[model samples]
Each structure stands twice: as C-alpha cells, then as structure tokens.
Target: MRPSPLLLALPALSTAQQQFPFLDQVKGWFAQASNSISSAIPSAPSPPSVPNPVASGAKVIADAKVQPLTKDNYQDVLKPGAATASPGIEEWMIFVTGGNKTCFGRCERAETAWNESTALLSASRSPPNLGLLDCEAEPVLCNAWAVGPPTIFHFLIPQPLADQSTPATTVRSFGLNRTTVTAPEIASIHLEEKYTQKEPYEGIFHPFDGPLAKAGLAIPVGYAIWGFSLIPSWAFMIGVSFISRSMMSRRMQGGAPAGGAQPAAAPAAGS
Candidate 1:
C-alpha cells in the first residue's frame, strides 16, 4: 500500500520551518524595541567605589592622623601653652605602648583601632589631638605616664600649668578590650562621656587602682595568713614527729642499714 499523503507533506513542512523567513524580521523588531527602550530610559552611571577602611596595615597607617610622640616632642604636643606647645592641640589622647613581648599582639591589635579613631576624629568639627607613645623608645615618658603597653590615656589640660601632674591623675585609661568597640565608635563614646557629659575626674581607672580594691585583696590575703598563723605551734610539730616515727619504724622493721651492709665495728684495734 502507498504511504499516506500526510507523510509525503512532512518533508516539505520541515523545509519551510528550517528556512525561518520571519526570524530575521522578528529579531529586527525586537532589536529596535530594545534600542528604543534603552535610549528612552536615562543611562545610570555606576556608583562610586568606596574604599575599605581597614583594608591593610599600611592603609590604616596611611589613614591615621596620630602624632608620634617621643620624649622630646611629647611635652610640647600634649601640654597646651607649654614653652613648646603644639600649635593646635588643646588636649591630648595618647596611645601608649611598651617593650613587653607579651603585649605585642595587644599593641598590634589596638593600633588598628587607634589609627582608625584618629582618622575619624580628624574629620570631626572639633577633633581632639591623638598621639602615639612607644614606651620602648621613651621609657622615661612611659614611666611618667604610669602606663603599660597597649593603654590609651586621655589627658585634660590643667588650669594651672604648675599642676603638671594633674593630667596624670585625671587621665582615664582604655585597656586591651577597647578593641571590641574599636575606633570612631569607641573614641566618640569616650569623648561624649568625657566632654559632653562632663563626667567628674575620678583620678582612677580600674577598680584595682582604687584603695578599696587593694583593701579587698589585702583583707582576704591577711585573713588567710592570720588563719594560718593562729594554727597551734604544736600542730605543725605533730606532723614532723609522726613522719620521723614512721621513718624510724620502717628502718627498724627492715633490720638492715640503707647500704645493705653494716659498717664494720670501727676497725677494732689494728684489725
């Protein structure tokens, strides 16, 4: 039997579809529409790329506005109206670091925050001066500041420069944990409390700096020592006596000298 007429038409249908006569026309229309839409809509320029603040150590340092304080220049900068007062600094916040190896990590960590805070402060309307004091470089200055490694000390200008030591007393300290809040935020908070709120000059930082803290520690230690002292004199002697008796009993039971040989009766007469 002959193949069906529909099967015979299949090849022609395939050839017609393959030609795709309307495809180019459809593409042209779509391209024109796309171009019109694209042209009608305003071209949006790309947003500017913002730099990451803490990108690298060098970058952080570059962005930092901290003044390096050495023995020579520290006094001039930190103290206002001194014989060599820095032109603009009203008061100072110093980042003090020491020579201790253990503090190296802390110092390195705190440095980034310190640098960042200084950068932020630099941008502010009433920026306070920030400085860095390397205790290793200036031992005398660090001793005078009474600061250890990785410490941040805020100093207020004393009314009477005669009270040069007043700033030391009023100086508040930020410890290693200051890195948690870090930079502009932490610096701003401190500034707010110090300047805006006008918190009183407590002249002390950690509780350990206070007499009560010392008393607290001392009381416990003293009590322990006193309790030990109150123990009867004979009580200690009892342990010693008991130990002595035990050793003696052990020796007696062994029935032998430690060397497993008794000393010959002291070389009796010319033996």
Candidate 2:
C-alpha cells in the first residue's frame, strides 16, 4: 500500500522537532490558532517603559491668591483681635504652689479641682482664666496680692467693684482657723490687704494708708477703765481686813488672864 503525504512527513517533522524544540513550538503555534497564540509570545516591548516621576521632575506653579502656611500666617490665624478676642474681664484663679516634696502633685491636683469648679461655675457663661504661680518663687508678689496657696478668694463682680472708690467689703479671703484650714495645709498665712508695689491692682487695690491707718491711737472701745474699778475692790478688801483685825485684837485683850478685860459679871452683884 502507498503512504499518504501527511503520513510520509511525520519522520522529517520528528527529525526537525528533535533538532529544534522552539521550532516544534512554532510549528504547533502555526498549526493551531487558539486563544493562547498571543499569550504564548511575550516580553512585549514593556509598554514603552512608562516615564519615571522622579526622572521627569515635577513642575513649580505660582498661585497669586494662596499663601503658604508660614509661621507668620499661622500666627495671624491665632492672633487675637478686638472682634474675636475674649474680654479682659476674667475671674482669675491663681494656683499657688510651695516648695515641698508633694507640692508639685498637690498643686496639680488643686489646679484640676479649680478647673472643674470654675468649669461648673462657667457652665452658664465663660469660664474664668486659670493661673499657676510658685509661691516659693514669688513670695513678695503673693504677699502683695494677699494670696495664700490652697486658699480661695472670690472676687465677685469685679467690674462693679472696680468702679467704686471704696474697698469692696465682699473682697476677702476665706476665713481660716485650725478647723477650716485644708488638709495637707497648703497655706498658713492670711493677707487682707494688697502690697503690690510693682503694679498695684490700680484702683482695685486697697492699702491701709487711709484715715484708719493709725488705729492704735488709744481709741477706747467703751468706758475708759483707768484702774478705777480696782479702787472699790481694794476698799472693800481693806474694810474687811480692818474689821477682822479689830475683832481679833479685842478678843485677844479680853482673853488675857489678868490685864485682859474679861466678860463683865452681872451688874446686880456690883450694886
């Protein structure tokens, strides 16, 4: 029987495939046109190696209206102006601290308490400003301000008080005694007047250089006791002593045996 061309080509193809493996693949590729044709060949020009951002470099553009957030601009945003400013009117809570082992922690705790209290107070309005001071560092200032650490002094309606010429009677530090002093005693000294020589609270400060300055001018509280009541006491004591002495002398004379005057016998016997 005679062999067909396709059958006769098998040996040559096998030899060619043996000589070149890639040609065998290429021949199969040519013979079979399937979805894998394009996929089988690759290294595909790498899509022109998309340009690197760094190598190409970025461009600089100028904006006429926009400004960079420089410190000056940032400060401008925070800068206080009349329109946006909180009023100078502020109830200040000065948290004074001393130099002690627990002072730092104690002061911090006091500050927190003050903040909470003031926050509560300001719930209906603006809160008072908080201030911290080291009493050890500014003793003179504290003295002048009549402020003691851990002591509370409320300046109620300061605006109205500032308007009045006289001292506001309401302006006073909380009265303290052994019973009232807070535990872990933060302050012991009490001041009722201001001595801020540097910058006195202006019209708000009340010093004792007034008419009542010389209070010790012998001003009597009531009846001037010139040791007069003592005179009556002395007189009564002297009278009592005189009567007692006289009675004692008479009794002694009478009791004497011969010279001593005895009790008189019945007058009838002498008659």
Candidate 3:
C-alpha cells in the first residue's frame, strides 16, 4: 500500500536533520570567508602634503615671531589683551620670523603697545566711544615695523591625490596600508585641523549644524551593514529544525493504532 502523505514526509524530515551537520560546516566556512574579505581591503592612505595653504600660512606666522611659541609660552601669546598697555601686552601675536616657521609668543611690552594702537585705530574708525587712549601710539610703531619686510603669506590647501607623481603615489599607498592595519595617522592629522577650527564637542553635539557631524554619522552606517551580514546561517537552520520536529510529532500521535475495544462499556445499564 502507498504510504500516507505524513509518512512520506518523514523521510524528507529525517534527511533535513541529517543534512544539518553539513549546513553547520558550510556556515562556518562562510564566516571564515567573510572575515577574509574584510581583511583584504587595504586601508586608505595618509593625505600627501603638496604644500597646504593653511599650514603655509601658519609657517609664515611662526617665522615672524622673535621666539617661536612653545607649549610653555603659548598661553602667554594666545591670551586676549596679551599685546597691550605700557609695561606689557597681555594678548596673542601671530608672527613669522624664519623662512617657513610661524610663531605665537607673548610680548608684554610690544603686545601692550600693539593692542592699544589697534584699539585706537578701531576707535578712530568707529564711534567716538570705542577708543583706548592708554597706549594709542603703539599701533603706529607696529605698523611701521610690519612694513619693512616682504611678508610671505602661506596658506595650506589640500593636495589632491590625483595630482601627485609616482613617488608620492607609492608613499601614499604605503601610508594607506598602515592606516588599514594600524591607526589612521594621516586621517588623524586632517581631523586635528578640523578640530582646531571647530571645537570637538560641536561636532559630537550638533548633528544638523555642521559638515563634520554629517560625515561622522555616515561612517557608522557602512559598518553596520558589514556586521549584520556576518550573522551565521546556522541560526536559521536551528529554528527550522525545531518547527519541523514539533509538526511531525503531532501528526504521528494522530495516526496511532485505535484497534482496542472501548474499555468494555463500563458495566452500564441492565446488562
């Protein structure tokens, strides 16, 4: 006699279970393949320096100073009102001294005069109430001092990778490999420039406010796709196996033998 549909399905059901071990192995292989693929792509290289306009500008500033700004003295020049008054100025000075170096230094005497003079100039041009008379003569001297030299203005502009020569390309390629395997050194320098112009918290806190914030948001989405695709196929296989077993057991019980008499009728009625 031909077997019922439920019985016919049993062989298929058993085959599925037997095939599970192979399926698990395949899943492991897939995971390994995915890891290898992720490892294959080389990291982006550090940006090649082809004379950045901004850095050049900074170098010009450094070159003008009598002394280069060190970590210890940076605070002196960076402070507001640093270049003011009779004794010493309490302000920031961007000066260039050597050929390509820019320095920021605190000059108590010169800065005071410079600040007072600029204030006077500002006051003279604007409303009468804006002028500072304490060191009004200093701006004139500073201006005269600034006039004698042929000041070089260096601005750092990003050098595009497409414009560089073969040697530059080779260097950049190696940098990219380092960035991929190690920390992103080149990218970090670019980030420092960005952070210098705008505060770090500004990037993190203001999502709709700036370009950096938008770029930051985009980077994580790419990572998420890679991560989810790596989930093992065995999880699905296990769930399917559980469901099939439950269904088969129910069908088997329903088809069990029913040949026994009905408990002898329980001695009912008149016998």
The C-alpha stretches of model 3 lying farther than 4 A from their native spots are: 1-20, 46-55, 61-271
Q: Provide the lDDT at 116 for model 1.
A: 65
- Stretches of candidate 2 exceeding 4 Å from the true structure: 1-92, 101-106, 157-169, 175-271
The candidate maximizing TM-score is 1
Q: Which pairs clash in model 2?
A: none
Per-residue lDDT for 225 in model 1?
A: 48
Cα misplacement distance, residue 34 of candidate 2 (Å): 66
lDDT of 1: 0.60
Clashes of each: 0, 0, 39
Q: What TM value does model 3 have?
A: 0.19
For 1-271, candidate 1 gives per-residue lDDT tens digits of: 9999999999997787679778678879999999999999998999999766464653465345677886466545655455434443355677776555425555655666666666566666666666777866665455444457777666555433465433222456665563464675547745565444444335322222334323444334434544565589999899889999999999897987677776776767977
lDDT of 3 at 243: 96
Q: Rank the candidates by lDDT, best first.
A: 1, 2, 3
Better-scoring candidate (TM-score), 1 or 3: 1
Q: What lDDT score is found at residue 99 in candidate 2?
A: 58
